[model samples]
Target: MNNIILSIIFFLMLSTIVFLIKSKKNISKLFLSILIFVGVLIGAGLLYLILMIFDNDTNISDTIKTMIPLIASMVAAASVVIATYNTVNGEKSSKNKTILEFIDITRDILEKGEITEKTTEILEQINSKLKSTDFKVDVLVNNGAREFFEFLNAVEGKEKIYILDRLEKCFYYEPGSPLDDLKKELIRKLKSNNIKDMRKLWVNINQLAGTPAKNYNILYEECSYSLTNQFIEKDLVNSKFYTDSLLKNDRKIVDGLLRKHFELKYEDIPIQYYEVYRVCNNILESNYEQIGHFFRTVHRTLKTINSYYERNSLEYREHIGMLRAQIPNQVALLMFYNAVYSEKGRGMARELLASNFFGDRDDFHFENNELLRSEHFLNNGRFLNNQDAHIAYELFTYNKESNKVYNELEKMEKKVVPVDDSETKLKEEIFTHYLFNKEKILLDKFIKEFHTVPRKFDEYKIFMNPKNNKK
Candidate 1:
């Protein structure tokens, strides 16, 4: 009976030790130490039982045998308790040390207002340490939020962009639950009114379309010069009268004079095409760098949100909605034009599409049945209707068919007979037509026959099936 009991106890102890070893990664040193101490006592008891059952010495008294195991257990237990206490204290100290180091590095980086390769390495270390079960993320988040905002406030221009870019890369590669929580907290901080500059950073980027020109006066001067030159060339201008009218800066007077003297209606007035282009070109030249930075900032922000939440989840929708609201109708319209026309803006367009930035039609609308006034410059006389915009949105966002079409168009451009216009212009025209018509069958037929056929917009009708072809 004694042997059987000892054997059962031994079996349980062995099983427990195996469990503790298996769980060593998860459990703290303190608990593991306690288990080890208990294991040693169990091991001593097993040895005593073995002696009684197998040795059959009959030399030692029962009291001495019992006392031997008891004393050994007590001594071993005390040693283990002291060791475990020291281990627990040391672990606590180490964790504290790691956290302090992380804080110090973060503060140094923030103060320096630069993120280099070293910064990334330090961030990785911080991430690794924070991933430990012993670390409390809430404490770090609470303390770190203010520091992060301070960092944002300190950096500007290219430096800020660099930081955001590196931070995004970090988030992508060094993801953990704690880091996710930190990202959420950082997002919340960004949205909060506590950091006015941070809020302005996002707001200003979204509001880029509000002011496309560096100087409104410069645009006015260019327009005035173009209009005056046209009037003089038409033999309709009284030079002094035109000069006085322009000085007054009254559009009605200018329009009335042009109508009465030059017989030019508002719509008939020659678009200052070259002047407008110059002004726009200047705007792009001056602010293009800033615009790229702004796009990157918005992309990184949305990407971070996207990483943590499912696309269809309520949290995702709410956050995305809040971001979308910051971009006004004109701005969204500008983004559409950028996406369509500019090479550098394509990635921004993709990010915007992923975030459903154009999910609402009303958000892209402006007064006077126009998408936006800037449309005149960007549309190449092929304006975007709501349906066209919606079709483009669907093709880009839902089906990813637009990208395929773009690729096919590129291939067709290379193979087909050269047109008078640039390849870009031809592609833009056909792509715009695709958006306008939303004719999938025609597109498919065009793709199939493009290699042999001349690339002309007028020839697109031939791709239509006879049954559905319009005269």
Candidate 2:
């Protein structure tokens, strides 16, 4: 009877403490919970002692037997409370540590003047201290590369281009220069499928070669083509180097890749041209309003498409050829619209669009093709009759006014020599000489070099205040 009463008291005490702890809200509920369990066990032991005193026939063995369960419950509660506290504190500490580490790294990089040396030291420190975490390993490597290149550029000027050229001629280039040994080493690593090690070597070579230039494309092709092909094991249509080249806007690399990939066979499908075209079309379709870059790429693609059509070898002859003719101009207009609202690029945007529209291609202008006309050619709209004022406004800003200013100014600058056999011969000879000179010799370059792009009266008038008429 005494034992039963004690169990009831124990249960009530536990319930009351839990409710109190929960309601108070500021107490350490974990510790309170542990204390409640201990209090309940003590109550049970008091009840066992009371029963022994009341009965007098119950011995010490009976008292111990009753106390055993209470002792166990107290120990279990204490263990759980200690474990919960440790876990909560440990997690909080770990989260704080991670945040501090990232902040430290960002601050160190942002503060350093000699970023390359700093980054190199950072890598060594991470290896020695951070124990090489995968979460930021690649990011660290890429950051280090950027820092190193920026440092090199600051010190070397444009002569870094020549240094890279010479380096290429030394290490995996130049016959009998131990390149054979490196080849053997690479083959062994590749056979082992040591992708991590192979990537490291490629990274080292790229750093040693320095910043990407026209010549880097040639060296990358020579070094990685066969190996990358074997690594991919699927008739590699595009090299990793080519993808990197794309990100850098190195058109020279792009052109070389197109030529190389065009000849490779893939599972009864010639995939290179098609793949390149598809990626381009995806870029065009998705990001039409932001295609400042699509102009040059589209121009190259169209030239290739024309070549294919002329040979009658193009698989998607009609569609690709039509797209090639049309998409570049559309991209140009969209880019112009995106730029015009901005203060910085407005004039350049207008000038670029006008030049592209009026530049050569007499053939495309006269052709009565609806696709070409709708996509590229400019047309006047009847605003008053159709009440199409918005369309008229768009046409005015995009074409008529801009083109008029561009053409008038362009013609004003030129000394329009009358068409003569002697003058044409002189021009032809000048162009030939310019072509052989290996320097920029275009009309744009000539204008910039000489500071001679003539300004038209209309463009000049926009900025000037009109003279007041006498009343």
Q: Best TM-score goes to which candidate? A: 1
User: Taking the tens digit of each residue's C-alpha lDDT, what string does model 2 give over 313-392?
Assistant: 33323424334244334233433322322223233333343232223233233222221233333423210111111211
Candidate 1 structure quality by residue, lDDT tens digits, 374-397: 321224233224323443344334
Colliding residue pairs in candidate 1:
none
- How many clashing residue pairs appear in each of the predictions shown? 0, 0
Global lDDT scores for all candidate models? 0.40, 0.37
**Candidate 1 segments whose C-alpha is farther than 4 A from its true place:** 1-286, 289-292, 307-315, 360-392, 396-471
The segments of candidate 2 whose C-alpha lies over 4 angstroms from its true place after superposition are 5-41, 44-52, 59-64, 111-471
TM-score of each: 0.25, 0.22
lDDT for 341 (candidate 1): 35
